[model samples]
Target: MKPEKLSDIKKELAGRTVQELTEICLRIAKYKKENKELLNYLLFDSDDPLLFSEKVKTFLEEDFKAMQKHYYHSTKSLRKILRIMNRYAKYTGNKQVEVEFSLWFCTNFLHYADLNTSHKPLQAIFIRQLEKISRLLPKLHEDLQFDYQGEFETLLHKADSQARWVSKSLYL
Candidate 1:
């Protein structure tokens, strides 16, 4: 069955009382893991976006380090990392945070993985993230967009260079 349009859903929700809306939210959260995660973020983690992004950054750094040092599952690990980053972006619902997260992911991926050109899937994931960064840049404030654009350019150039500069230091 086709779902109702967003406007219709908004109208229906607008008519609901506070307790009724809370009940509906709780019921929805019970049915899906993602829904539950989003609800938790809204309820508890939405106060300080900078703090949330920093937490995500720290998590990403740790995961990337672990993958680099121990995990041999290249494509699988990269996909998992990207999925987590995307999920965090969804939680914040902020374009700036999304862009920052994407930038950090790309930076860390380049530094840690230096993705072998022969690995098509891994390369595709990197390219897809760059595309996401490009898409998100325009949605940011003009000054922020200009700043991120510089970083994005650096990443693009790094991707273009055939030479792989894998950092000897494992921790980024």
Candidate 2:
């Protein structure tokens, strides 16, 4: 069976009593981890998007410290970290959180993993995040964009100075 449209779902939900709605939500949360996570965020973390993002960053920092330095594991770890970050960002419906968290991720990724191993996939993942930042920057508020741009440029400079693979020109 096909899923109902969001508008139709909303209309149906609007007709329900509060108790019924709560029961429905609990039932939905029982079926999927993402639904439960979204409920948790809405109930506990939605008040402070910045705090939620910071929590995610701290979790990522720990993951980075634990990451294996080998190229294969490192790439796998990066993908996992991004998956976690993206999930949190998706809950907030905020571009700034996504952009800021990604920048922090890329910078930490550079410091946590050695770049001179001639692993193109690792380098490409790094560049892909920079490209994501470029795409997202224009969508954020002007003041935040300015601040993140400075950090972005500084990140690019650090990358350029430290590795031949990360070119500042292509991203900016």
Candidate 3:
């Protein structure tokens, strides 16, 4: 699959309303699920490893495209949130928490994506880094609402620890 043109997606999203963008996000999620299913089939069911590898590579490319589309749609909501925060900050005279939240949100989202897409061996490393960042997020400010923080931290630590054990077990 050809790489998605970021500029084209940005242009398309720029003209769409919030409702339309949400609809597009749903469609993109559906497409991503379909792509993942196809990849799983190619990876696990094919007799020819070479052919399967090629198909998997193609599937990954398509998956990335879908991810780009979803990210583009999400950017619309993120921008709106940032705009509202900016306005609120201006009136309230407190921009630090809002800015920190925006930074944490963006970084966490990208790290989550990277962790999901990384190879099994490297996934643990990313997850560990994400966990560290997640911990720092709460320290950034007290005003930030980190809903499900406990659940996420637990999951991240579990994933990283399991992956590390697996890697070490293989080595031993």
Among the numbered candidates, top TM-score falls to 2
Supply the TM-score for candidate 3: 0.23
How far residue 29's Cα lies from its native spot in candidate 3, in Å, is 41
Stretches of candidate 2 exceeding 4 Å from the true structure:
none
TM-score of each: 0.78, 0.97, 0.23
For model 1, residues 85-166, the per-residue Cα lDDT tens digits are 8898988989989988888988887777745555666666776777787788888899998898888877777666643532
RMSD of each: 5.4, 0.9, 18.9
Give the lowest summed-lDDT range of ten residues in model 1: 163-172
Model 1 local distance difference test score: 0.78
* Candidate 3: clashing pairs of residues: none
Question: How many times do residue backbones clash in model 1?
Answer: 0
> Model 3: residues >4 Å from true position, as ranges?
1-69, 107-172
lDDT of 3 at 46: 42
Cα error, residue 107 of model 3, in Å, equals: 5.5
- Candidate 2 per-residue lDDT, tens place, 1-172, comes to 9999999999999999999999999999999999999999999999999999998898788999999999999989988888888888999999989998889988997799778868988887898899999999999999999999999999999989888787899887
Better by lDDT, candidate 3 or 1: 1
lDDT of 1 at 162: 41
Arrange candidates by lDDT, descending.
2, 1, 3
